[model samples]
Target: MIDLKSAPELKALEPKLNQFFDLAKTKITAIDAEYDNSKGSPVFTVEGKYTTRGWTEWTEGFRYGISVLHFDATGDESSLKSGRDQTVSKMATHVSHIGVHDHGFNNLSTYGNLRRLMLEGRIPDNEWEKNFYELAIKVSGAVQAARWTERQGGGFIHSFNGPHSLFVDTIRSCRILMVAHRLGHVLMGEGDKPINLLERALQHIESTAKYSVFYGEGRDSYDERGRTTHEAIFNTKDGAYRCPNSQQGYTGFSTWTRGQAWAIVGFAEELELLKEFSDEELAPFGGRSEIEAMMLKAATATADHCIENTPVCGIPYWDTGAPKLHLLGDYMDRPADPYNAYEPVDSSAAAISAQGMLRLGHYLMAKGDSAVAEKYIDAGLKMSDSLFAEPYLSTDPKHHGLILHSIYHEPNGWDHKPESGKAAYGESSMWGDYHAMELAVYLQRLIKKAPYYTFFA
Candidate 1:
């Protein structure tokens, strides 16, 4: 379990957060200066240099979003200019993109962060600029919602794998839909039917909560509470539920730690987003109590599982059931070994999940659940301390990555393996770098008592 006994308070981590932003400013600027955008979106690091991965163009937003977030943290007008200009120049396709389940990841990071900064008065409020960002968000949410698959219970936004596949990662991405709903937008379907974005988002959330997350209720022999299957398969012909599957993990039965992180953060963020909706607005989906219960169940379960399965430092290997994990006997009893010849640790997961844990903790505290909330809050802080320090934080001036040891696709052997080692390590990804910066800014906000950070805000 995560040892919360000595987790550093938010104030204590300010200097380290400051140090991270310093390193980040250098790395972000270098990537912007030297990275060849014509090649494609910079996905991950190869030998400490940024490289492109030819998946979807899912990471382009993070590229610009990092700068927007840096500006939020340090008032770097240059960074803000980069973020704003690139987002305007490069992100229009993403708003209307109908090919992938990453609208939230792509649009929310760039457009959403820019919008949030304007609302917070971190940026000068210009009505035209603000409208541009909000319209992008609204359209992005609707576009994301259009990729839906109906089932007996409800429906979910399908993954790029097609209408039959639902990915757990989309749970976090579902926020675009929620944000659009808040912006009074809807998906206009066939015959000009107005599809409710909030309803679609809620259905997607419920579908994910049901199939993607396991609750230790004997759903299968491998069923364990908080265990997340990366993908959930369905029979599209009749919309019948099929089985669990994985694109990035060891297997459907084993938890991929990053997918688990997505669940933890996705559900926690959704829980907080619910507070923005009035009871009347939420009544059609489910009452606030019911919605909170479902989200809380998933969030806390995954958070608990993370604490139980992760190393003392709170970082986890790429997957819980990576075949070679057994070679390192009782690995969870010690700090994670990114240098281990057997497996690679994913600092990106820790960075993403740390924010989830923190958000969940704060949400619970708002509900007067202090004792239980501290566990998650401290666990998040523990992850922050580990992620902000050596072996994880990249200090090398030549490296374009902000955080080290992020795995993109271990199953496909897509990560950069060291010449001396059998496993891939010492890499950073666009999502990983973006989230690390986001997490750092999140902590800094808490320290300064700034307006609470949220995508909707």
Candidate 2:
């Protein structure tokens, strides 16, 4: 479907991706700085140096995931060993963490990548090691899925905020359940409910589709076809939907670019898993076709917005409706300027969303929409190529982050607003750096003619 034959882009990218891994190993990973693991993978950088900022260890997985990707992309065995060793030494507690709603971000990147590597024959064929990885994934997925809130039709994995909150951010975490379901695992809920994880996955996807994603379908007064809210609040008593809310964005009504990226990545990635499900496996959720249609709709809408909202370089301001962005007239027509003193460009949004666009483009091409698919594919590749170069990439050894200008929480004033005071430039986020590696690895694999990165795989 991707039509990789004679891909000029792939041929051009293969060497650059490998070179990035080489530079990252020395500059980013080799740094002696270590933040409190409790802060979740060092939320952001100050003076281009990382420090702890998050409340939970939500991003530890990304740190570990980048290692796996480094090895996968560059065939650097030390990177692989770094990934395996870190998971063994530090990831056990994350697998069983109960309070936070980030098992997918914590355990999945570590355990999930380990299993995926072995399954791909990149790691040695050791059954004990494989089973260890699998068991960890099974429990991690079940534990994450067990954080449930039931509604009239079904339930969703609740956020750390408890039963009343559903975040677009958690959609990517639902992959923990998707992978667990593929392994034939299920979560045990109260009343001894044998909660089917696949069902819960679909339920959450469907819930996010209805509440978080805007389709200009008049679900609410603010609804626009491609607009998405960061958080969706509901009344716990009856699961009746409440007003839109946001923890990271400027306001409940504004679209957080990272949240939009999550919707794009979550739906696009899950759509691939949806195809792997058997008819019987999806019967509880209106069959595979119905589920596919649901996910496809969500992915499509998000990708459309991603293309429309981003600058020509495929980077976006942290929030589309960020109040001060009016200063940067025609930002969408040209590459975003990080020094505008109006708003910072989120390379993290570009890193995360580019892959989502690529996946969606591939899916559409597979589904007979090549004309539209090419646009998405080109957009994704354009973003990916930009991220691999200067200003975005950390070619400077002084910079501890791979991608720059990533904000952790703009509204909270937690991000380091550089000396300019105009925008939070000269920074990095754990998610941003991790997703940049992920974007590079996604393209790297395609160029190398290797197994595609898939949650189901």
> What TM-score does each of the candidates earn?
0.99, 0.95
Task: List candidate 2 stretches off by more than 4 Å.
Answer: 1-8, 32-40
Q: Which regions in candidate 1 have their CA more than 4 angstroms from the true location?
A: none
How many residue pairs clash in each candidate at the backbone level?
0, 3
- Superposed on all Cα atoms, the candidates' RMSDs to the truth, in angstroms, are 0.8, 3.0
Instruction: List model 2 lDDT by residue over 196-304, tens digit each.
Output: 8887888998999888888988887777787888888888899788889899988777889999999998898887776676788688779888888888888889888
Which candidate number has the best lDDT?
Answer: 1
lDDT of each: 0.92, 0.80
TM-score of candidate 1 versus the correct structure, residues matched by position: 0.99
lDDT of 1 by residue, 1-457 (tens): 5667768888999988999989888987898899998999889989998889888999999989999999999999989899999999999999999999999999999999998888888888999989999999999999999998999879999999999999999998899999998899999999999999999999999999999999999999999999999999999989899999999998999999999999999999999988888999899877899988999999999999999889888888999989999999989888898888899899999999999999999999999999999999999999999999989989898889999999999999999998665678888999999999999999998999988999889
lDDT of 2 at 9: 64
